[model samples]
Target: MNGIILASILLRIAGVGYSLVLLKRSGDRRFGFFTVLLTFMAARQVLTVAGTTGTGLEELPGLVVSGLAILTIHYLDRYVDEEHRIKRELKDTNEELTIFKKAVEHAGHGIFVTDPDGTITYANPAIESVTGYEPDEVVGENPRLWKSGEHDQSFYEEMWATICDGDVWDGEIINENASGEFRWVDTTIAPVTDGGEIEHFVAVDTDVTDRKERQLRIEDQNERLGRLNRMNELLRDVNRRVVTTTKRETLEETVSERFVSDPWVVSTAVVDRTASGRLRTRYVTGDETAIDAILEDTEEAISTLTAAVDHGRTMVSEQVKALSNDDITGDTVGVVPLSYRDRNYGALVVVTESSKLFEIIDHELRTELGDTIGSAINAAERRRELVDDRVTELTFAIEDADAPPFELAAATESDVHLTRTTTDGDGQRIVFLKVDDVDAETAMTAAASISNFSDPTLVSAADGACLLRFVASDTLADTLACHGATLEALHVESDTGDGEIIIDTPVGNDVLPVVEALSSRFDSCELVGRQEREPTIDTAEGFRGELQADLTDRQLEALRTAHLAGYFEWPREHSGEDVAAMMGVCQSTYMQHLRAAERKLTTNLFGDERTSDRRPAVA
Candidate 1:
């Protein structure tokens, strides 16, 4: 029980305790190595205390050395365990860093880091493709280098404010590329914070140029469609007004008002072509300032109007400036021709603040609206003529004419008389003419020789006079019809191409347009006579006498019954059977009489002198 033995024993116990703690904590087999040395030292101390070996002092050196050895092995084992733990931690850390590096380098979105002052410190590989700049080029520069100037300084200030407050900011940005082209990017910026203070900013950007452009294009197309729809609605309204209005002035005012009502049209003025070929503003509507602006540019306005009326074309200009001190600016002016079937009525002047109006008023819309209005005006003139008792008759002598009647008379040396003129489905002029001193074959042959005439055929022949049917282009009848006039008589003298044209029209109707048309087609056209007279109609007794000569009593009765019963009215007021019942006759018999009566009336009105073997003209 000396101090050496006691100390050795104590040292061995301490080593054992330490080894146990290490083993419990690490479960490493190396921790048991210190236990084996402690056991050897304990056995030596036991032998010296029992005196089975020399005294404890003699074993003391061995014990001391053994204790030291035990101490060294214990500490070494602990050191080795600590070394293994450090190596494992280092390995795990290296693996995690590798994974993070790979993710950052290969990310699809552009990733960039900037220092606190907004200078770019590092940029990922994807940044080059998105920004069109190399990583090295941008590393030392601020992100402002690629700014497209599309966004104002306030935009950047707001973004910086949000991110610097440790809040993320996201928006769409237009940035410039290295080649001076612009690109769109969806970007998100977040501040990297340390202890609630911003250290750096990290930005992720995705290229969205194609998608943004497509969206913009779609928006533009939608705007155009909207404008077109508005214009189409205005045109539809004008057509509706034309159908219901029976006065030229009323129709012009209505159309002008309709145009002015549109959002795009600031003002409208309808210019009329007078009989003397002079232009006059017939109706003006809408904003007074815009109208004054158009009037200010008098020369340009007149030129556009004249071109529309004379050339049958639409003229548009953006150079028409708005009046001074007016709210409107950069106004557009357009003149659309109003013409139909070789007749020029006038022009429609439209003033608009938006150029989009011109884009919508394409050629098709211009032509359709112009022709519709022209036809309506002509119809109004015709209605006025039918209702008015006073009529104006004009006679013109045409020399060197190229019409069928003139050519036929010159070629056959016969007097040609026009009996009737009409238009067929194809718009060709179908004329019936009576030629004296020529057979049917001779008259048709002569008519067929004219270049403007086609499909010549014989209608009938009696007493050395032949009724010939032919189709002609650019005839006097067509010209007179276009100007709301009716051809009363047309004759060509024998052995000469000179002809006389007599037309009847409303007293107030302009006669110059038709005369101009006639002059343009003939070498020498002169107004031979002008007369005003009251219109005359046959007395009822005389009309009844004429019908009595051509219609049977039963046919006349059937005709009179159907007419009074409103059978010929549109969506007929009475059916044929109903008319027959009213007449107290069987349906078939009454229909027979009605058909015969219609045939007689048509012949009486249109002059049917057709031969038995002849067919109606198809032209």
Candidate 2:
């Protein structure tokens, strides 16, 4: 019995090993079968061995029963271990799935999933809030249902092209919701890919309608403001040009031409202040009849404008009832003060039918225009004064009066006393004479004693002085001859020194020979001066003294000789032929020199040719 038990144990172990191999291959719970086989093998072996090498049927039954019982216990233990491991794995997988689902559903931006044909497959709750559509309603519907059609076809074309290329499309879009209300959205659509091929599209969007509208309004306002600024700049440029011109006609024309299309300017006028302190219209644009009537009643206009000025304000009136009997319709008038140096000069009246036209006429523009008009008026007045002064001086010089009297006294008592007198006829004839230095009676006796003094008559006599007037032929030559006599007889009791004198005379061709003779005689002792006086325009080319009158060649030559012989010099100096050549002429041929020399001499002796009439030639 002990040997049988040992063999049965060995058979049970072998059977369990074979059954374990079978269960491992079958992938089923075969461990129980393996244990039973092991028990049967052990029992069989024991029975055989116990029967002394003979088979035993009763031993086989006992061996099989013991093997089956052991196999069942082993197989059951293996199955229990596998079941516990599978349960643990299943629990972990469920936890991970729950986390993923929560993440997808709770995203902030409204997320949408669409099929390749743009059909909405899924949408988050955020989509309902943004588009006013429930997730169920949007799903399976074309995403284009939300399109506002505000975006052009090209816009959608580009969007679809980008997505089909597996690229993300990001931009602004206008969309319509379930309520048919339009809205702007900032959207991003990206293609979902499966194995590198686009499968569907996912779009995330946010509402941006309010921000977009605000930006557009701001842009429009900026554009309008920019246009207004440009208009103001143009107006300023026009104002600058208007203020710079002084001519009345030019000013009016410029203003009318420039502002012809301007709604504020119905007409333009330049009002000049008269000597009587009343304003008169000098130039005007538009209907002459109206302008004439307005100018005729300037006092009333002035009174109205003055009231406006007194308040230092612009006057706006809808009707001319205050100045005219007629009711002027369809007109608005703005009267602005024109001032210079803070003093009122005149007024500018602008007329328009539109009240808004005056909106641009602010204080700054009014003040600037006022200043410009003032400056132009002042400049015009100065030019007038200058012109008048010139005319006065010319009148005096041409008349050949005794050049008023020399205000400065002579430096010496011995200086020759020069007296001037005019002839009775026409009074164009002028003569200078010398009288003996003696008491009046003695001078008269001496003058009566001179037989050469023709028609000698006493013009004036006083205090040892006597003035004798006589008609002399060739008065200029006679004057020079008398000066020579005075110079030669200086030691004589009644001598007046070498009578080196210049004569103011009319120029003519016959005067040349007489001038040459005088020049030869008075080569050292005295000098002769010749001058021609005539009326001429006070201009650069027409200005001259001796040559003032139309000159003859001979007369011009005579004048030239006189100029070169120290006649026109400052201290009465001389430079004969050499000076004449330097003046671009031969000594005898002095007409050309006379013209140029006279121009220079007159400019120096008088003033510039432009203002030459204002000054007289030095004695």
Candidate 3:
């Protein structure tokens, strides 16, 4: 009995110590109750072993305590096992959280967490580089701190609505940084939900300002290229119209209509300033309101138009009230000068509703279009003058010693008379001139000294006159021809090298432009005379009379007799002697008369240049 009691007491003591440890570690009420039961059993066992038991009292206490302890120990073992399982799960959860936190901290893109109200709760280190703000500064602040205000309130409202509904929101946002510079960010925001309740929101942002700006620049370049192409096509069409139209009025009307036909142009008007300083509307198309507006302010309108015409420049205005409409306001107005080779004829008024047209019609386009229209109008006017019969004669006294003809005459001390002027296939002028008081060699030497004369060749010389042929460019004849005038007669004096020129044109053509052009080329030129005259009845009959007068009676008789007797036939039926007998003259005399007549006729038929093989030296 003593051994049993002793063993029971030792075992209860061990149980009590283990139970206390369990209670401290688990802090469970069941382990505390088990510890109290184990202490009672240990004390009861000690009492029973100390010989203090009677009437089964000690045994009873020991039995009850031992039974409670055995039951508590069973429950305590289960409690301890359950606590160990929970500790293992907690360790796994903490390790996973550490990995996620490190990933968020080291991410390249800005990662941030916000509460349901968009207040930033946490931000990664990358937020400093992305938003120009440190993580600490962003935390506990509203995301609106970086708002650039480029977007309206509705933009943020819509984004909030989507995120609040637990859906992801993705878009590009323009935000201001700490430095007050706008930045473009591609952002994705997702709601973090816990058990069907919103906990927080997670946003990942990428800085995309550079990429967005580059895309915008590319789009701008492409738009400019497209506008340039459109302008080129329109210019080509205008050029084609200029080439085909033959009347000034028709060309003006056509050009006005063509400009109005463009989608951007709302109206076009062509106006000519008359010599009396009056504005005459030549051709008008599209909206008449714009043109009426321009004319309403007469002084201002005239001033603007005159500036373009006088200066021969393009004028653009954005403040024309008449050009504005209900649908499109601030229309652009352009006044393009119509001038050719420095002569102003009119101005073309254009009203455009598209700003792109302003960009398209740059300086180059304006100048080119003005030149095309001016040239076309000038050509059409020339075509009209060509078929008229009434002639205007202009006589200009050219005293410039620099003129090639005057220079040659002054150098050789001779009178130079231009006989004829013709052009070769290369468009170079071939001039035939008779130099009196100079031999063929002296005339050639004088011509060679002039810069305007080239390829001088002596044709023939006889009786104090030398006929010379040479190539001359930019002479009085060429200048007059350029202005639709024909050179009628030219003469240079020997003593003073003074010269007179006579040019003829259709009666209605303007002589001022011609005179001005000539004056520009030769400084000492003066218009000494101008007259209108009717063409004489100089037909074939008159030509025949002139030819007869050029020949003597004997020469005429020889030529007529030879023609009637077949002396000119290839196999002559009558010889030169036979024709001479019919004409009552010797064969040698008849041949001499015939040869002289043939020479004169050939000179009249061709240009007045006669060629001979012999070249005479200067006298």
Candidate 4:
């Protein structure tokens, strides 16, 4: 028994020491809990050792204390494992946040987070780079601060509507930078959602100002091209009509209409040099009063245009105010020389609102229009020249004294009823006699035969009442002597005279003086006809006859028959075949007779003056 008590006491002491050591090694909280559990277990174990000699109740206490100690150790281990797991999860979450933040800060695109109301929640550094604004300055501000006002308020309203509806919106936006400059941006706005509810808005933007500007420029160029095409078509139509028409009035009207109808043309006018070399307005569009003002101030305009045309250069006035016209107000005036084949004909003055607008008119278009107007003017002038030529030719044909004879035989064969005669027997004649009444035929024949003659031939009609002057030819001296005879006696006179005499004759307002002067000198001489001299044909004088022809029955019969025939009409009123048939002969035979008759009559009437002996031949 003594040995058992001693061993138990020693074991109790060792257990206490071990329990103290364990409490110290475990931390303070675990230490207090372990001390209590170990003390209970030690007391139970001591009791069990002492009860071994007595009841089993002592073993039960020891068992309960040991079970409590095991439960405390297990709980402490679980607490420590739970704390370690929480720490590891916290570390992983922090690392993920660091990576996300790094990505957001360094992103290339401008990222902005805003409330559903468009208030900026967060702006990345890219926002400052793109907008020239500090992130802090823009944060918490409504995105509308960047609105350029170029787009209407409805644009922003639509954007908000899309974002609030949880839909992504993408479009271009014109926005103002912090520098107060406008910038175009391509933006995408997406709604941020939490549990099916919109929580915020996110916008991704790209600076697209350069691209937008380029697009606008392209559109402008296309519009200009369209305008150029229309101008080309208009020019072509004008060319076809204006260049071909000879009427000056038509061309002027067309130009006026075109100028008034064109939206781009501010004003237009045609200026021409007058006889005095001063520029005169011929046609104008815009305001007539303004046109008058321009004309009044045209000394300088004329000077400028003359310089341009003389130099064959284009003159562009920096502004219309620089032009001489005080009434004209515009930014630019274009003076284009109108020319054909390098010859300057005129100048076209075009006024415009802008210099750039004038520049837009293609060089080829101006050149073509200038040439067209010049050519039209040239054509019109040429037509006038032709008409003048025709008139000149007709006057000369009527007035020439030594004109080719009217073929009486051909006239007779053609059944013409006009009597043809000459002064005396000289065919150098001004007037061809045609008797309207047979009662006057005798007096007319007698007046023509005795009038003035170097060579004379008389043909009496088949009836006893009339006679015809068949042929007459006289020299220039003889003709002039006859003219002096009529001039010496004041009387109504008509006679074929020398070329020099006809040239010396007076005309126009001077003619009546000549007639009066001659009437005071000659008795039977009266001024009966006036002669017209023209460049293209021969010249002659007209005369009044007071004497008639005396001839045999057969000669007078032939003369009357010839006078009844159509011969003197231009392009012949009767055909040669018909004339030959009327003459009772073959066409060829009758033509030969007609030629013979013409030679005989011309030679007898003109005599020595019929050919080169009379006057020098003219071209």
Candidate 5:
């Protein structure tokens, strides 16, 4: 029995210790009840082993203590459970707070936290890098240090109000950094509230300065490209007219008209220097009177005009409103020089009142415009020279004096080309005749109808013309010495007999006796033109009467038409196709007429034997 009691006591003690350790480790209320049960068994086992019997007072005290101990165990277990729950919740909260702090510190965007009064409390490393300020410099300072003047006071007030109202604010802001340079940012501000009142503000900002700058640059470049394209279009439209015009008057008129028609220009004029060095107004359009008014009022305008021709450079003059009238007030006049191949012709003056419009006419653009006009002038001048160099003046009429019938032959002067020269063959005199503008059929008809020559040997009859080799005896020179006409001097000949002849005469020589002698051979004769021109210089007066011609009526008309229509220079300054179009003829036909007139002119000047005597032909 003693051994049993001792073993029971020891077992009970071990169970109580184990239960206490479980309660401490697991914080389980059930483990505390097991500890209390073990304690009561240990107490009862000790009392029974001591041979103690259950008495009234002693047992009652033990029972009360036991009851108190049981109650203490139950409440102690619940207390431990509640304490463990609180510790777990606190640990989780602390872990979450640590994660949030690290996130804020490492963020790429600038993060700043401010107190309720807008004083900066914390600035992340990113905020310091973006604002050019260290954390120490920004903390405790107001965000006003970063404000840029781009936004008004009202903007900041509204932003602050939104944040203070426990709301989030998002916007773009231009701020100045520590370097005194402005930066753009996309920013969001959130108010952090505690105790039902706004306590702090948190801001996240992303640097967007580079993006904004790129956008602005792209817009500017696009605008400039559009402007350049428009200018090129205008230049192309003007150049088309410049290339086709072969006359100075036409070119000037076109330029002035086009310029005036543009919304920019008010008036325009072309001032050319005459060969004598005098300024002449060649062409004008769109309030042309303004040019005259300017010339009369401002001596400087005349100087500028002279400078344009003498220096062959562009010049500009401005007439303020005080010096100008309603017709042309506050005009910015640009005198563009007309020069080509280092030759100066004159100035093309353009005027406008708007300064902005004048800005569009840059130096390079003005030069190109001048070059277009200059090229046209150069082409026109060359054509004029070609026409003027061939001028011929003479008169000739012929009829048979033998009372024999002469056929009044007729042919287009333009359709016939004749060339004659005197040559020697085998110690004998021969006249070479090359008749052109004839096809095989025309050659046959001409050969059948003409009895003027003997022994005509056909040389070559091809390409709508004929080359004939003629065999003439020495009697050719003596056969018609009285006729006094050389092969090369036969000019403007027509079957209807309306043509002219050249006579090389000194100033005092009387041509009446020789004319009378020639008239005796023909039934009648009359002089239609005469000219004793001296050598000419490059002047207006020198070039006058440039078309002094003794051409047949048909030949004269052809030459005149060629000159007026610029057929001489039409179709891009060299091709006369346009002249053919205007004259209602094929290009070949028109060329035929023009070449015939030119041939007749060349012959009359140097081939006519009458002119070799140097005597004037008089009626």
Candidate 6:
């Protein structure tokens, strides 16, 4: 064992000596010195172990030193690896920072960095595009130099207030460039903090002047289109009302009401250019106080109307002031002539207090309106003459068998309240009325109530309801009538039942008259339906044919049977079963057939859509 241990020690000493020599040759002085120390220690260990070099206690310190040397070398190797790793990580961090700087520099939107004092520290090329000031010039300068003066100082205070609070500030702002032209930008500014204190600010902005201008133009166009659409709707209403009425007063009233309803119009007044060459107020509505003064101002209203009548065209008065009425304000006005076939009926004047330009309200629309009114007036006059030539003074009373509506019953119960009705070419009259619910005392006074309206022949009346027929100025039982129109319907229901009249004006007459008269009477009137039907030669056979045409063979048979059985009489002379037996059919079947026939006939005759109010379905 001793010889083996001695050989091991000798081999270690020789190895240490060779290592020192190798290290010295390599010019590594530190490692060479370490190798020499190790060689001397190894020699000492060999002698001490053999008890020929030193005592065990004396060699203890050398062993301790050797162990510490090994530990230091291992730690030094780990430290070298850690340093390499740090270098690699730092290289990666530097590369990432370079990429971030390049990205900001090439960004399309303006980018700028500022110190805590708001002094520009860095600016990208995009900022140059925005302010027309290069980075070299903008650096160290406050962004206030590019202020357009568009915003007040308070706006800047708010911006700083937001950014300084560490909250991001984002919104649109206007600025001036080097050329002194205003530029709009959408911007965002954010604060960078160090140790919970704001250190700097980074601002990003995009140019949006072009986009903003485009948006404004689009809004303007939409406004113009909206105005045109509204005007078209108003004109359509006028045209529709002129469908069944041709009364001059009616036309004027309709025109006035529609014009006033428009948002652009402050007031409307219809003035007539009478045959005596005098201006007379016809119909006026909306802000009447404002219009009355303007109308009384002879120079403003009369002069404008005269010009319109003389030129036979619409006249526009801009910024017209009424000197006659001191309290009245000035506004833009339009006067259109109502002329037909070389005859002038009147002039319609509309005033607008709108500050917006009136160019959008086309002149052509006003002219069309004037022509329509003139035509209606002319038609009314023509129909009157025709009615006078055809029918003598007479009245056709409603029969008890033909039931009138509740409103009609109330009107019939009052002597002052007369049920005025007119019929379509098919000899059908539908009258809607709001009357005092009295017990059957009103008179059939269509002829007396209206100079031109046809008298209705009462078909049957029962249970406070009656069905009457009035066909164009030739009463159902001998009456007179004329031209007509349809109205933009209005309905109001209150303590008084609604009186809605579905009048059939004479062929070619505007329906405006019926709507106007009914509205004046009931405070609310609505048109049921209107057709552009021409007046046909009055004949009972034509009316009968119209009803028969809509009925099936079975329906006609049932209707004929029911009439013969006196089923149309008040209190129904016979039961439905008896009538059905007379027709050799089940009672239900007969009633169904009868109701179908009645529905078709009433719908065609009165333009009444109700299936509940059976109009005694008899021919």
Superposition TM-score, candidate 6 onto the true structure: 0.48
State, as a TM-score between 0 and 1, how close model 5 is to the true structure.
Answer: 0.41
The parts of candidate 3 lying over 4 Å away from their true place are 1-92, 113-117, 164-167, 191-202, 247-264, 274-276, 284-288, 294-305, 319-330, 384-619
TM-scores vs. true structure, each candidate: 0.57, 0.32, 0.53, 0.40, 0.41, 0.48
* TM-score leader: 1
Put down candidate 2 lDDT per residue, 83-181, tens digits, no spaces: 656766777777777775565567666788998889999898788767889888899998788888888999989989999999999998889988999
Worst 10 residues of 3 by lDDT: 610-619
For model 6, state the Cα shift of residue 155 in Å. Answer: 5.9
- Model 5: ten consecutive residues of lowest lDDT: 403-412
User: What lDDT tens digits, residue by residue, belong to model 1 across residues 1-619?
Assistant: 7777777777777777787677677777666766666776677667667775444586577657767766776677768778888989999999988987788899988999999999999998999889989889999899988899999999989998898788999999999988888999999999999899889999999999999999999989998888778777877778888999999889889999888888778788887666556566778888666665555565765666678877888888776544333586436788888776777777888887767888888867787888899889878877887787687988889887565677778877898878777787887778788888888777777877867767888877888998887776656666666677777877899765678877787787867687777778778788889899876555768656787888888998999999999999999999999999998989999999999999788765554544211122211
lDDT of 5 by residue, 53-75 (tens): 44334444444544455556557
lDDT tens digits, residues 1-619, model 4?
2444444444444544554655565444664666565666567556656656744443554445455555555565566557557878888888888887788788876788988677898998888766778779889998877888999878888987887888899999888999999998889999989998888988988888888999989988987887777666667777777866776656766765675455666677666564234566667776455345444655544455665555556666653334434555544566667666644555666665566555666566676677778678656645654554421110101122222122221222111112332243333552322222233444443444343432323343333223233334432323333222111111011232211112132121113223333333333233333444443333332100100122333333333334456554576666777666766767787666666555444544432122213322210
Each candidate's root-mean-square deviation in Å?
14.7, 24.2, 10.7, 19.0, 22.7, 23.8
**Residues 179-250, model 3: lDDT tens digits:** 999999999999999998899999999899999999889998898888778778888888898899998888
Candidate 6: C-alpha RMSD after superposition: 23.8
Q: What lDDT, from 0 to 1, does candidate 6 have?
A: 0.63
TM-score of 2: 0.32
> What's the lDDT for residue 316 in model 2?
62
Preferred candidate (lDDT higher): 3 or 6 = 3
TM-score comparison, 1 vs 3, better candidate: 1
Q: Rate the local accuracy (lDDT) of all candidates.
A: 0.79, 0.54, 0.78, 0.53, 0.63, 0.63
Whichever of 1 and 5 has more lDDT, that candidate is 1
In model 1, what are the clashing residue pairs, if there are any?
Answer: none
